[model samples]
Target chain A: MTRFGRMWVMTGLLLGLAMPAGPARAQEHAPAAAAQAGGHEIDIQHHIGDSHEIEIPFVGIYELPRFAPIHVGGLVIDLSPTKHLVFMLLSALIVALVFVLSARSIAGAQARGRPATGFAGAMEATTLWIRQEVILPTIGPHGDKFVPYLLTLFFFILAMNLFGLVPGGATATGNITVTAALAIIAFLVIEVTGMRTLGPKGYLGTIFYRPHGLPGGPGGAVLKVVLLAVLTPIELIGKLAKPFALAVRLFANMTSGHVLVLALIGLTFLFQSYTVGLGASVLATGVLLLELFVAFLQAYVFTLLTSVFIGLMREAH
Target chain B: MVHALMLALQEEHTSGPLTVEGGLMLWTVFIFILLLLVLKRFAWPAILGAVEAREQALEQQLAEAERSRTEAAALLAEHKRLVADAKGQAHGIIVDARQLAEKERAAAMEKTKQEQQEFLARARREIDVERDRAIADLRREAVDLSLAAASKLIGERVGTDTDRKLVMDYLATLDGGR
Candidate 1:
């Protein structure tokens, strides 16, 4: 290991040794400290997971507005907003506001025959880069129509991912339901694009597993049936697996990073030692930086994969 | 179907990491759809269209510039050719003028030489005619004087055709002998 790596390992070992020894002394303080530790333990999960309350920094936790469950026949569904839902709305609002303002600024600049400036310039560059690099290249030439949808997905997910790093914000993208919904949209777009590009007969070719150049006899007919029977289920699974992977990958990556950061901070309270708290703070800060990187990475991966899947479906063999 | 989906959602919502809140999904779908519609309508066209238009304008300007450059090159070549043609025409004019001047000078010299030769020939012919006339006159006068003197010496009128014939015959014999 390099010097920095060795030093980090040594510091980790020292913290590991001191953490267990410090808790014994922490027990000498009071029962109230133990109660606080239990509270911190519970807070870690609630902090990363979706809940009914929003925790504002320097403000007490506030319960979200509750609504009566919708009932249809024998079914009851809770439609009240939760913490993640509130943040999701915030992300959407931010995305809409920024893009709209950028649109205006860009339009004005274009009218004046000048280039875009300031935040508007940055937004334009990002939009162009995403369209030219991510969407058009992966989704091919006809992907122009899909630019707005994919751009929205990229920015919205990115906004949600970054919001999770804020002191009192929740990551909507970390939720399975949220990722799954986005995935479902992507799945629909991909499949529908395939259906439209390849007519009904052509689209069926993807699922039916018809091979070219089969023999010209009864043996060929029997072989064709056997191949269809064997390959159809596999083709169906392949189609479904794309969206499933997109949803689970985004959800897992976003959630895991938050869990690690929360768990690290929770350790400071659990040990009840100033040294452990300091160590945990440093470690948590590092992990938070990694989480920040993960946020953008996950967003890009989700968008790229979605575009690739759409392209693949459009050009299915 | 609604009951079954609700049951599954409820079960997952209370469960561990794979919690599926139906409300969150509904909210996501609602927000995404709305955002897509609004942004697509208000934002994408203006921004994307402007950029594409700017790119097209740049390409057109570049093409026009290239065309003008090519036209200028062709015009320059034509101008150079015209200059060279004018220079060649001027050279041809000078050569023709020199040749005409040389021909005229040679013709004038030939005409002057011919005139001098003709004058010399005429002068020689006139001189010969004058000499012949003077000789004839001298001969006639000699004959007349000889006849007069003979007639005076003889103291007789012998001035007739016979005396002229005798003198003419004597002159012919003298010319033949000389």
Candidate 2:
């Protein structure tokens, strides 16, 4: 994974800086001139939104192949890969390459009685710290088995988030569609792991009884059953709400940062001056850095919350 | 047609950022699962195994070092005890030898002192006997000379027992009177 991660990162960064006057150049005149900007509002929308073409305003805009009209037994399904989808593929490839490569280094270093140095060592430290400190502590010792799943989520989201900060790359997490899919996976894991660990009855017991068991005597059992039935809908809502929050939190955080940066850039044309453009770039720089921080922070929060949910389900109560 | 165009433009402007296309979500799921499978199969096991193996090796090395140190300490204590024991034994033997030497010297001195006393007594007895013999010889010679002088004065050869007796008796009486 490290190999692909390095390749993608280098490519992304180089394409970003070297392409000067590229996407950033797309905000020309008043941004209201080309795609119908609403005093910078429309421009901000277009900038963050997914597009069917790779647009580098100064050089070219290449329209992607459209497959929305494909017919399969009279049922048409659109399966074309958009800009975000391409980056999404790159993100996956990056994740696969980084982990696979680093795993090889770690395995090899074991023979020499040490760890891999430089980049590989840093990667190893992160993996270990997250597994031991974040996942295992929350999920318990048995949580060791789930380390790969949790780690993959972290690095994948992290890669995509950071990639979005690069000049031309679309932040996949900024799209609600992408964030919703990730949240669905988390929800499945939480519910499925709960079922598997607690065994169907024990799983329902979480929504009903307090982990120990149901009440003892007849009157008490009746009272408890009444409480469980009364609160079951609320418990069900709580279960669904956790993943929803996870998805929205990330989607909002990433989308807001990009919107802010685009707005700062759009301010240049709003005032119609080169000096304003320079000043706006300076201000945008600060927000750009904040977006970078948010990228890492949001990824961490998503992974941590997912782990916490899994832990709550796995452990006794 | 112009109103339709106007509506299309309005929709285009609003449709981009917030739209959650079903197709993109499906694509994302497919991509994420592909990543998960690839990582799980190709990467995770090796990395986790290497980490555990390294930990075990480090722990084993530390334990071996501790054992060796303990054994070395025990051997050092044993060596020190042996050296102390040998020194004490040697000192005891030296003291015993010195005491034996002192006793032998004192016995030899006592024997030599008794032999010297006996020799002195014997020498004193022999010296007294020699002195007595010398005095007797001198007296006899004096008696003989006195007898010869009397005979010459009388111009006669006298050999009688009575005459000899008288001479002896006269000498004895003269000595008693003096």
Candidate 3:
């Protein structure tokens, strides 16, 4: 067999052997933790709500909360250091690094065959794929201009989503506030691109233009105006609904996947049975794999739909 | 008690909402706009220029390939025409050589037949001359024998005078009778 074929075969065999052994090991070691627990079980804190109480050390305080709020000019801000913000900044840095590296690669013409490498190649492939497959096809000519924004949105959401999967990690996307911010950005881009391409008058016309076919006559113009007026609230609501939907969809999917994995793992503690723990362990592993797929899928879906919305706004009709 | 608990929860929920009220939104908007501007100004033009350059290069290569293909096809056609012309010339030369050989052979046969006829005529003329000479010699011999027999009966050999006299007398008698 060819080298690649043999490598694939070896990989498949390794996975086949490893998959069963993992569950078996979990099954074998199930009751040891329960025996150690005796009457008192070890409880790990999983705080879902916003407010969390924490104990401070060294300063001889009776009680202390995990987080505090600071007010600045009537604005109350949470002073707690959250990992989500770190992940966001990291994502931005990663994007900057990718662009800088790719730019450097092309800067010197003498460097042949050095387009992109490793992470850079992956980032470029993703950007180019989205531009060619999703954006350009939907947005038509001059669609390449929006590639950076689209790529940024995709990687940002992806990094945030994957960051939540790490141990003790909180999902920024799970918070409605973060998702709403992203959606609002998309909303702004769409409106701005539309206005820039079609002018303000054309933009308003896009919202109001209706094909003529109704039961009324000259009165129909008034009816059209009335209908448009009535539909204005609905259109505005729809615009808000888009970001809300984006936020909720990502937050719900990520939260639910994590919850399921946690629940499966929790089952072993609730019931001190080896077979049940083994089954749950296997199921949780499978769910983890699925979560990986969901991470990428949600990111792609968000970026693809956002680009589509932008394209729709940019369209003439 | 329930009221106090509700108030506590409400305070908890409402405490931080105002602190970052417009600040976060403003920052997000500012950062996003900055990102868009920077990307548009710096990164976008370079990326697009590279893509366009690559596309143009590909198009140029394709055009060159097509031109070369056309040139090759034309060359092949020219070569085929030349080969066909050469084949036709070769065929014509073979035909001309065959025709020339046939004409030369016919002329040679005609010349050879003329020479053979001349040789046969010369041989027949020589044979006729030889036969006439032999006949004259035979006639002279007979006359000599007749003269010898007559001299033997007269018991004397005939001399040259006698022979001439006999020939004259014979001739004179023939003229008188005439």
Point to the candidate with the largest TM-score.
1
Among these predictions, the greatest lDDT belongs to: 1
When summed lDDT is taken over every stretch of 10 residues in candidate 3 chain A, the lowest stretch is A40-49
lDDT of 3 by residue, B1-178 (tens): 2332233235434323112324334444554566556655555555545655666778999999999999999999999999999999999999999999999999999999999999999999888898768765664565577677878888788757769467556655665675
Tens digit of per-residue lDDT, candidate 1, span B102-149: 999999999999999999999999999998898789889988889888
Q: What is the Å distance of residue B136 in model 2 from its true position?
A: 16
CA RMSD, predictions in order: 9.1, 8.5, 10.4
Q: Which tens-of-lDDT digit does each residue in A1-317 have in candidate 1?
A: 24522443444445334432112112222133335443334233444568787766435568988899888677666789888889999999999999999999999999999889999999999999999999999998788998999999999999999888765677889889999999999999998999999999889988887778999799999999999999999999998999999999999998887666545544655565557766765776667677788889998999999999989888899
Instruction: Write the residue-wise lDDT of candidate 3 on A164-246 in tens digits.
Output: 55433445565555666788888878888988999999787666765457657788878888888877677677667777788
Q: Work out the TM-score per prediction.
A: 0.74, 0.73, 0.67
Question: What lDDT does the true structure give each of the candidates?
Answer: 0.79, 0.74, 0.60
- Interface DockQ of each model: 0.27, 0.29, 0.08
Residue B51 of model 3: what lDDT?
53
Candidate 3 backbone overlaps, count: 6
Clashing pairs in 1: none
lDDT of 3 at A309: 80
DockQ order, best first, reads 2, 1, 3
Winner of 2 and 3 under lDDT: 2
